[model samples]
Target chain A: MKHFSLRKLFLGCGALALFILAWKLVTDAKLVSPIFFPGPERTYAALVKGLSGGAMLSQTLETVQRMLLGWLLASFVGVFLGVLIGVSRRARAFIAPTLELLRPLPASAMIPIAIAFLGFSDNMVLVVIAFGALWPMLLATIHGFAAMEPRLYEVSALLGLSRAQVIWKLALPSAMPMILASLRLGLTISLILAVVGEMLASRQGLGQSILAASRSFRSPDLFAGIVILGAIGLVGSRLLSFAERRLLRWQAVSR
Target chain B: MVVTQLSTRPRHGEGNSTPASGEARIRIFDVTLSYGSLQIIGGISLDIAPGETICVIGPSGCGKTTLLRMLAGLARPTSGSVELDGSVLGGPNRSVAIVFQDYGKALLPWRTAAGNVSLALEARGCPGAERLAITREMLEKIGLGRHADKYPAEMSGGMQQRLQIARCLAQEPKVLLMDEPFGALDAMTRQALQDEVLGLVATTGATMVFVTHDLEEAIYLGDRIICLQPNPGRVGRIVDVRLARPRNQLLTRENPEFLRLRRELYDLIKDDHQ
Candidate 1:
């Protein structure tokens, strides 16, 4: 099994190397115009320069800041609403339909309306990211609270736990795994929406950098921007999973 | 080995400093529980004395669990009252705790053994500084002190059940109600836990209502056994277990009176099934 993982990693790296070689071969053969598809060497140089000693570093930071702020806002609102809907059947019945109606509408599609309301601003980008990221956490929390074992409630009553005690001690802990899972999903959505908002709203992030470079026919700069975005996503997701593993370590104990 | 453990455990005067506070007399009067038009516990009544162990035995669909739930104040009787020490039971009384059948579901899977036990103390508003000592003390009492840091999923079935019982005991409850708590365990673990429960009851002198399907278990553990008939359950017969105190599992099983009582209970239960 250990060798299998090593072999898997080896295979993954091999595939990436193969793809890069193929792209270089296509450029060498003049299969596409250099103006359209930049050579791998030029793309790599652009990536190194932008990250090490250029404006791309600041662009990456701006994107990350917006994403994190939006995710934090989404998390607070999602958990508050989720707990409210989870603990009360009346609140769920009253609020669930509207949420369901709004849930299916794509966040990207709302960019026009968002721009109309709060045009070309950082708040607009943050709001778009927050709105896009809230659903997963909200829905996950409600499901988590609903799916709790019935017997635990009986134990709670037998212990004479008050309403507040039940919520703080039982409800929150039981719902934590799902909440964390949804929060991870929310973080990913926050990143995606942040980039989209930056591109559409003409803000100073990786998304705007890529779009402007593409329009100006700077293909190397465009590819560099995309690579940085991928690296950011990889790092963000790994961090969230690390926290998830720590929080839910017990679930893995006997199983 | 379990029998020796049972016989050698702490006696009433050994562990408890205040015996009277941990004992409660349960008065049940014509309590009938219904779900819409369906009756469950059909007008049953009984009196359980302090420190006396009463085992309830009945066939499936006999409202055995419902009766236990009503006593624990987890369910309300549709038309009657259950009282503890002459006070009418309203909601869950702070002085009562229930040990449920499915230990896995009853426990908080995330909390460690000590944390689960501490849940009861926390519910009762036990001071933060005092919780650690009481949690450790309760776990040691239930023979789970070594596994204090282990989660419920990490423990065996018997250990999980013991943890559940420990959690209940941490409440310092006056009346202990168990609803087939050992039904999921192997016979050996069941016997060991039964003896453990017997020892705790002896030490605290708490009134106990143990619900089980096993006749020998009822005879071994109870001062009296209430056998209920099926289809809207009510008492069929109440048999007195005149066995001596600190009863040996092996010796008590061999006793002619035990055999005779077991025979009588078998016949009574068989009649109800018919």
Candidate 2:
């Protein structure tokens, strides 16, 4: 296992080196305009300057905070409604059609409507992010609960578990793997929506900084922001996986 | 092998107020189960005595599982009632537990052997302090003491089934309903589990209603065997297994009475199919 991970690490570093070398080559050969596409050194310099001056740091912190807040709210609402519909036939019949109808509408489409109602406030951006991230969590949770084996319910009933106990102990725990997977998907959506929301409606996040740098012809700052966004997504997903592994150790052992 | 004479005592509650020697622990009174218009179980009546291991044997569609479900209070009879301890059972209560056939599905994959057993104890409202001790004791009883920390997925089929049995036993049920508990096991594992179950029932004195399609298995573990006819299942025959207690696998199979019972049950099932 250690050797395999070491091999993977080597390959990952090799790929990154190749990408940076290609970027440097393109810049040296003047394949693209420097104004539009800066060199890796310039982008790295911008990143270091932003971090030292605390400008990019504050913007990144804002984006991270908004993303986490919106994602948490979405998770709570989505899981609540998902479990409700998943468990009850009447709830599913009544609510599923409406949810299905609304689910397909892109979160970006809601941006104009959100701006119209809430204007250029953090609340407007949060609304967009939360709305964007809710569907994956909701749908995955519903699928998880619905696909559970009937025998588990029978066992619960025979054991004389109360309805609440059955839902809490059996249904929720059984649906956890799917729920966690959906949460990971929601995290990606949350990040994307947070950036998009900031670019469109707010003035205080990495997305805004990237947009401002582009408008002012600061190519290195724009690329640095984009790179930072990518780094955030990568790190966030890795952290979630680490938590999933820890919490679901039984699943790992069982497999 | 010692030959124990079959008891011909009359069933309890015939005319006396005192609980008789063969007092019925569970009574199915003209129970019929249907799904919409499709009848799954036709009118069937049965009386199971305390500490008796009654096996229900039949063809595939013979509602053996349906009968067991009704007894477990997981399903209700369409026409009649199931009585436990002289009272009509309305729904699943603390007095009964079930061992399902598909151990893979029945036992929680997320829980260890001890944790799965603790699920039953938790449901029964056993205090937190006592749960660990009881869980360990139950697991040890099922010969899974060394593997208490293992999840169901890590265990072999036999081990998983034993874990499931241990979980049910942790419920401290007065009546245990098993629906083909060992049906998926290999021949050797099935035989071992069968003997283990017989020993458990003998020690616990719990009334058991085991459903299976294997005739020899029914005769080997059962005190009385109920054969059901299919296509709207109903009891076709009730055989009293007069074999002695603590039965040996080889000697019991070789016994003339065991062979006769097996043949009789096989003929009954064959006639039903015809």
Candidate 3:
């Protein structure tokens, strides 16, 4: 297993090196105009310049802040409502149809409506990001709650657990694996919507910076911005997975 | 030893020889359970004395589990009443704890063996400072002292079952209901757990209602074996197991009385299935 993972690591690095080499070859051979497609060297130079200037740092932070805020709010509401609807038949019957209908509509599509209602503001962008992230978290939570075995309920009930105790001790923990999975998915969606919202309707974020760079034909800066966005996604995913590993250590051990 | 013939009608307060041995710890009075138009448990009545270990044996769909659930107040009887110490069992009573057959599902997978046992103490509002000590004690009692840190999934089937039993015991219950808890274990593990349970109950003196389809197991563990017939399950027979206490797995199985009781239970079940 150790040797296999080492081989996998070598392969991954080789794949990345090959991709950069291909990009360098294309740019050096002028397969595409440097005006449209910047080489890896030029992109890296632009990225360094942006970092030193602090403009890219602020923009990246802005986008990340929006994503985190929206994602957190969505999680809070989604889990709360999901559990409520999951456990109560009446609540599900009353609320599920509306959520189901709303779930399929893309979060980006709501940008126009959000702009109309809230104008071009941070709140507008945040609302859109939250809206986009909500469905996955809500649906996952509901599924988690619904999938709970009846026997757990029986065990808790026989133990004379109060309603609050049952939910806290059994329901929440039992649904955690599913809940965490949804949060991972939601985090990605939140980031996507955060950038999309900035590109469409906001002024101060990585999305706006990227859009601005592209409009001015700064291909290197555009490439640099894209790379930064990818890095942000990578970091966010890694952080969440770290948290998942810590929180679900028992799940891993059991497996 | 007295054996009661299967009675289709409710025969509340009729089987126990010692009527004055206080009130029945758990009294099922003409209880019937149904879902919609389909009856699952037909009129069934029985009484379990305090500290008695009653094993329920029957074929599939016999409502043995349902009866156990009713006794635990997890399910309400469709008609008639189930009483715990003379009060109608309205809902789950704190004094009752259940050991379900599917230990994998019954135990909280997210908790360690000790954490799972702690759940009961926590629910019962055992003081925070005392939970760890009690958890360790219970885990030790179930022979899982070394495995207290292991998750239910990390443990083998028998270990998980022991963890479940430990959790149940931590409830400090007056009544322990086991629903085919050893059904998934191997023969050796099953016998070991049987003896462990017998020993635990001997010390605890808790009223036990164990449900199983295994005739020999029922005979070995029970003070009285209640056999139920299926198709809206009802009491079919109540056999008194006169086998000696502190039963030896090898010696008890070899005892003539144990063999006779096993034979009798097997014939009774065979006739019911046919």
Provide TM-scores for the models. Answer: 0.93, 0.93, 0.93
TM-score of 1: 0.93
Q: Which stretches of candidate 1 lie over 4 Å from their true place?
A: A1-8, B1-24
TM-score of chain B of each: 0.90, 0.91, 0.93
TM-score of 2: 0.93
**Clash number for every model?**
0, 0, 0
Superposed Cα deviation of residue B154, candidate 2 (Å)? 0.3
Candidate 2, residue B138: lDDT: 95
lDDT tens readout by residue for model 3, B225-258: 8888777687887889998898999999999999
Query: Candidate 3: which stretches are off by over 4 Å?
Result: A1-4, B1-20
How big is the positional error of residue A145 in model 2, measured in Å on the Cα after superposition? 1.5
lDDT of 1 by residue, A1-255 (tens): 799979999998999999999989999898988887888998999999998999999999999999999999999888888888988878888988999999999999988988999989999999999899999988987887788888888888888888888877898889999999888899889999999999989999999999999999999999988888888888888899999888888898993
Candidate 1 CAPRI-style tier: medium
* True-structure lDDT of candidate 1: 0.87
lDDT, candidate 2, A1-255, per-residue tens = 999999999999999999999999999899999999999999999999998895999999999999999899889988988988888878888888999899999999999999999999999988888898999889887888888888888888788777888888888888889889888999999999999999988559999999999999999999999999999999999999999888788887744
